[model samples]
Target: MAVHLSEPDRLLPVPGVRLCAVAAGIRYKDRNDLVLMELAPGSECAAVFTRNAFCAAPVHVARDHLAREAPRYLLINAGNANAGTGQPGMHAALACCAAVAEVGHTRPERVLPFSTGVIGEPLPVERITDVLPAAIQGLNPQGWMAAMRAIMTTDTVGKGISEQVALSGGTVTLTGIAKGSGMVHPDMATMLAYVASDARVESGLLQAMLGRCADQSFNVITVDGDTSTNDACVLAATGASGVAVESTEDRDAFEAALLRVCRYLAQAIVRDGEGATKFVTVRVTGARDAREARVVGMTVAQSPLVKTALFASDPNWGRILAAVGRAGLPELDVDAVTIHLGDVRIVVDGGRAPEYTEQAGQRVMDQAEIMMTIDLGGRGHDQAEVYTCDFSYDYVRINAEYRS
Candidate 1:
């Protein structure tokens, strides 16, 4: 399959990181379904995952392992979700981690496992274990697109991004690949993302920066408001560039480059959301913090009523108002809220703008991309942005036959 290549402005490999993929055939009848990435032993890693109460076995396992001081590898499969399978599900994940550990010559606890596609099924770790030796043998650094296609299930396209960071002595590279187009929400999405960088960063610093980057990147998208069982994003620093990142200046530069790659991939995921024809950006300003602003924006952006109206170009701002009311924030003034659809004014003072016309609003909504801005004219001042798309018939059509 021909994958969508990332634009030149975003095309670059992670410095010092070599990657390769082999067809483990864990669930699919053919094609590669497993990905193994080996990192330098002292590399630092940071991750964020789904908050789903029934998070998959791997999500649970990876969360605990991320607390470790360092990591050496990541193993991901795109077939069985390995979710809601109870205790044995975890055992299966551990076994797979152990297998990869053996191959990487690292402890099982140093490897992280991630799974996506389908729910409530036992993960056949043996399928991955059986072919892991081949994956290990096939490991290289150039097959970025190949690794991307190997991790897709319902996704129709592959998502990847890269960026470069200039260090005092040398340049560092960052690259990431993601697979997710449905069952997206946050506290985390159903997505599985692997990012690698050549800059040597401390574990604590990487974790701190990842948390901040995720708030603005991966956490900024939603497809169905359904968090997945195996959502995760990891950055494995290879120290290949020989840039010793010790001070805050180096950390800041590394985090910025990492965020650049992750943010682009996150947008790509939204653009490729299941059945999405229009990509929308919801920008909420004058809130109280990123948390409140994003909450309000996601509530509005993810509303089926609002999204369907957008799909049909209906220009229904009332749905936006309804969503803001239920966003579970501190006291909000209905009289102080104003919303704009692109450049078209829709709501003013929390009510329909006197100059509002459905025609103008609809015209703006019909565009392939639209922006919704919410302003709170009070001391509640903050901002956040979320990416979403209009819900369409194709979305239902694609997901309905997903597992059939």
Candidate 2:
């Protein structure tokens, strides 16, 4: 396999994070599909995962591992999502983690495993185990690009984002990488994301913060409105910064920066979605509260009619209204609605804005990035935003024969 990189391939160094990428070839023919991210000892962790009742074995196993030990390394593979394969799947996932722990000289509980692709088939632990030594030897700061690329399946580009934040001990850096393209939605975490930071944060608090941040970030984005069985997002801190940040100001700054990195990569994931052409940003306002607005916003963004029109570049506003009416917001006042495609302003106060013109709507739809805003007309106190992408026939083609 050729090294096809993405816009997020730029190299970055976060103080405590070390990455290694090697070809395990779990399902892919030649390229590296397994990545090992080794975080320094004393590193804290946070995670969010899919709410899908039938989630993969590794998803549950990793959560249990994090509960038992502070994370030291993460083992991930693509092209073989370990989902729906019964008892054997659990054993294989545990074995993969054990192999990594053996190499790191850490307990198996200190390692987490993640897998993606072809549900129901057994994940070949031997593939990763055979390559573990070389994978470890390949470890370094320079492998960020390769590590990010290794996690992709249908994603045309690798997604990574980095930033630094100030804390009580000082300023520490955060780095993150993620992958998702087709089976995307906003329940728990809809895809895979791995993040590490150098700051000292408590695992309990960091997990809580990560859940909240993703609820507003990953949980709001939709690609085809389908949730994946392999969705996993984890945050690990190496405590290399020597700063214990507990103050509200310090925590908020760190949280904000973490959110920034996650959001950037999440958007990039959607942008590189299989067969994706246009990136869509949906913003909803005027609901009674943020929750209500988010429900309505995601409902609109996930509508097939809405996305299909996007693929065709057809300027359709009625589809948007139809989605909102059924959004389950309880007595949603249709009369108090307004919508806009970017700045074109299509609907005004429940009806087509008098100035609505096909030419203007066409201009708005033509942009590479499309923004659709809705005003429920309540107050500024309530608002929600989501990100998604246009659906095309290529999306169908890619997933139809995905494992074949």
Candidate 3:
């Protein structure tokens, strides 16, 4: 039910990466639900995971494995989020890694596991292990799109992107895939994002760059204001193109390319949010600091009244004003606040604009895409933007029967 999104036209694969997807029949019947990705040896990896106190077992294992060594394989399964199972869940996830390592002929410490879908249910380990050989046998260098689809749980469309740019040494390729819809909010990362590049980047630099990129991209989007227990974003550098990013210019180019892929994937998640009909962007400017600006934007974006008003095209600017006022800004001056809905200034100097009319506001809200800006009129260059989707009736319906 996304407003303006469809299956990607094409998703080119990155060098030094091979992937395959299979129907493990873990929870879904006759559908591809498991994905396995193999990375070239010596590829550097960096990742950020959810801050949820009750994170899944795979997240725990993946964190530990990533710390121990460079990962060789990424194993993901949909339809059963191995969460809330305590010690048994951890063991089950480890078993999955063992199976993947045994079949791929690699050390178990080098395999990372990920899971999504229904929570609190035991993972069907045997079903997943039984199909490991088939998945490995079907590995293809051009399996990016298939893997994208296989990781989807509530996502309506598979999301992916591929881009190339000429750096100092040569042309580097960046390819990324993401899956998310519902239970999305920014803490560390929004949902599952895996982006790989064909450039040589040192381990420390890769980790720092991925963290900064994620803060600007995945960490700024929200849907339903619910942070999932399995959110993660990973970046891998294969060093396959022989393009070692060693200079400031090369780093800038590589960072720009990575940002493009991350932004595309992050926005796609909002566009395809559960039962979403309209995409909304909230911009806050003139704040004292970036954190405050983001707090204001997210507060407005997460307001249920604001989202429902957007869905109905009601042009109820009061809900937006109320949310901003309650953003916990201790130094905010009400007299200096201004609000705009897609250039239609609704509030001026903390009150309704004299030139504003109901018809004008209604026209702006009727569009499928909207931009709402809040200016605090402070003497600072700080600003932030948060992407979200309008809440709709079908959102309730989807969750009401999610497991049925």
Evaluate candidate 3 by giving its C-alpha RMSD to the native, one decimal: 1.1
User: Which window of 10 residues has the lowest lDDT sum in candidate 1?
Assistant: 1-10
**lDDT score at residue 266, model 3, on the 0-100 scale:** 91
* lDDT (CA) per prediction: 0.81, 0.83, 0.91
**lDDT per residue as tens, model 1, 1-404:** 11233333333666555566777666687688888887766677888888778888998889888776466778888888888899999999999989988887888989888888888877887778998888888877776777888898877777887777787867878888898888888777879888888788777777788889888889889988888877888877877778877777777787778788778888878788888888889999988777888888899889999999888988888888898888887677888888899998888876999999989997898788888998876536789899898789988998888861
- The TM-score that candidate 3 achieves is 0.98
lDDT digits (tens) for residues 103-126 of candidate 2: 889899988889888888988889
Alpha carbon lDDT of residue 184, candidate 3?
89
Task: Give the per-residue lDDT digits (tens) of candidate 3, residues 1-404.
Answer: 77788878888778888999999998888789999999999899999999999999999999999999999999999988898889999999999999999999999999999988888899999999999999999998899999999989889999999999899899989999999988989964337889998799999999989988888988999888888888888899999888998899999989988989998999999999888999999999999889989999999998999999999999999999999999999978887899999989998788899999999999999999999999988837899999999999988898898961
**Which of candidates 2 and 3 reaches a greater lDDT?**
3
Best by TM-score: 3
TM-score of each: 0.93, 0.95, 0.98
Index of the highest-lDDT prediction:
3
State how far residue 47 of model 3 sits from its true place (Å).
0.5
